[model samples]
Target: MNDNSKVLVALLAGVAAGAALGILFAPERGTETRDKLNDALKNLGDTIKDRAAEEIDNLSSLKEKIVENIKTTLGAAEDAADQAKTSATEPA
Candidate 1:
């Protein structure tokens, strides 16, 4: 997977572990702990979704830039070749 996905996965895992520990040590009722854990998980999911979208957008932009650079370099090479051909065919 992409970097963003990896980071998101790591973050979610950490959050889940932390929540589990919190619930274990919390003095509150079992129902309250469960609710907090659920909220945390839902929020983490939303955050990951948003970040992944942004990362995809960035990757697309980078790809476009790379394609453009390649086209420019090819154009320059073609121009140089044309100039060399013309010079060689001219009277010396």
Candidate 2:
């Protein structure tokens, strides 16, 4: 996989290991540990969702810029073509 994927995998593995260790050494009861795990998972999920949304917004913005560039290039080409046609049809 790519570097980003590798890093993400490593980070997830580290988080899992750390959580396991924390649970093992926790001073609280099972219910408290479970609650903590649940909260951690919910937070992780929210973070991933936010990142995805941000990436989507960035991609959308890039797409709009590309489209605007294409339109401007096409308009320039059309203008040039019109000028060439007018010159060709007129006296030298």
Candidate 3:
């Protein structure tokens, strides 16, 4: 993975850890604390899923752009080669 992806994963992990610890330490009933923790975990899971989808879309877009550039470059090269061939065959 890239640096940005690594950083995002690290940040999310830290946030999850911090939230779990904070909830565990709060002076509340056990059931309430457990419920809060469960909600926090669900939220984190949703966030990760959303980020994964976004990353997949970004990668797909990048792949398309790269393919287009390669096709354009190949076409230009072929055109140049054809022009050279025509010029070489023509009479002076």
Query: Each candidate's TM vs. the true structure?
Result: 0.74, 0.78, 0.88
Which RMSD values do the candidates have, in order? 2.8, 2.6, 1.3
Q: Candidate 2 residues 1-92, lDDT tens each? A: 55875787578768866886797689999898888888877876776678668778988999999999999999999999999999999998
lDDT computed for candidate 1: 0.87
**C-alpha lDDT values of all predictions:** 0.87, 0.83, 0.99
Q: Which pairs of residues collide in candidate 1?
A: none
Better of 1 and 2 by lDDT: 1
Best prediction by lDDT: 3
- Best first by lDDT, ranked: 3, 1, 2
Q: Give the candidate order by descending TM-score.
A: 3, 2, 1
- TM-score for candidate 1, please give it: 0.74
Model 2 clash pairs are none
Candidate 1 local Cα displacement, residue 18, angstroms: 0.3
> After superposition, which runs of candidate 2 have C-alpha atoms over 4 Å from their true positions?
1-13
The reply for model 3, stretches above 4 Å from the true place, is: none
